[model samples]
Every structure is written in C-alpha cells, then in structure tokens.
Target: MIKNIMQKVMALACSFIFSTGLAFASTQTAVTAQLVKSEADGTVLICQYRTMKKIHFKVLFTHQVCPLAIQVGH
Candidate 1:
C-alpha cells in the first residue's frame, strides 16, 4: 500500500512537471504585416512579415489579407 501511494505520487509529480514544461515552452509572439501602396484607388502592395514567437519562435508568413497582424499567447 505504501509503495503504491509513493508510485502514484511520483507519477503525479512527473505529470505536473511535464505539463508545466509544455506550458512554459509554448510562449507567445506578435506578428504584423503592412501594405505599401503608392496610389489611392488601386495600388501595388508590398512588404509583409511576421514577428517570431517569444518561446517557440514560430512565424507565419502571408500576403496582403484581412489579418495583417496577430498576437498569440500561450
């Protein structure tokens, strides 16, 4: 009975550690994109970039779109 309890406690501790590690690993990041145009009616848009995530350093690249910037926190 004591051994079983100890095993269960160890398992719980390991699980908690693993979960915390994952939670901390997946941090957060801010991404932004802008359109450089010359004309008003219709213009050519250029230059697009996404900021790297703080923890994972993940970046998503795309062209001109509705969501020019996005911020995700884990």
Candidate 2:
C-alpha cells in the first residue's frame, strides 16, 4: 500500500540523516598517526604537519625514527 511505502521511505530518510550526523561527529574526534623511519642515521629530522584543524604533535621515540602522535582540534 501507499502508506507502507511512505513509511519505508521515511525510515530510510531518517536513517540517512542519522548516519550523516554520525559521520560528521566522528570527524571531529578523528585523529591520524604517522610513522617516519629514517634509512640514514641522523640526530635531527625535519618534519611538516598538515591538517584541516589545529593540531599538536607529541613525539615518541622507540628508535632513531619513531611514530608521530597527532592531536586534532585542541
């Protein structure tokens, strides 16, 4: 029936809206980590960071070259 079809359409629309909101919300808390491994021995390394929002870097050393921790939007 037409009512049943309309109900299904409304449900689909609500689900889509809810999912899009979740996707945007997730991006706010999302963080990306990067690892840099140096093949040549060096004491100091040059690094550049790029992001949509403000970020801070926490450098962790496991070896000569280690992973970089990135914090977004804070």
lDDT of 1 by residue, 1-74 (tens): 99999999999999999999765663353234332222222343333333442322222233333334445443
Candidate 2 residue spans exceeding 4 A from truth: 26-74
Q: Give the alpha carbon lDDT tens digit for every residue of 1-74 in model 2.
A: 99999999999999999999876774347655443332333545433344545433444333544345444452
Model 2 clash number: 0
TM-score for each candidate, following the candidate numbering: 0.36, 0.36
Provide the lowest-lDDT 10-residue window in model 2: 33-42
> What is the TM-score (0 to 1) of candidate 2?
0.36
Computed on alpha carbons, the lDDT of every model, listed in order, comes to 0.47, 0.54
Model 1, runs deviating above 4 Å: 26-74
Per-residue lDDT for 6 in model 1? 100
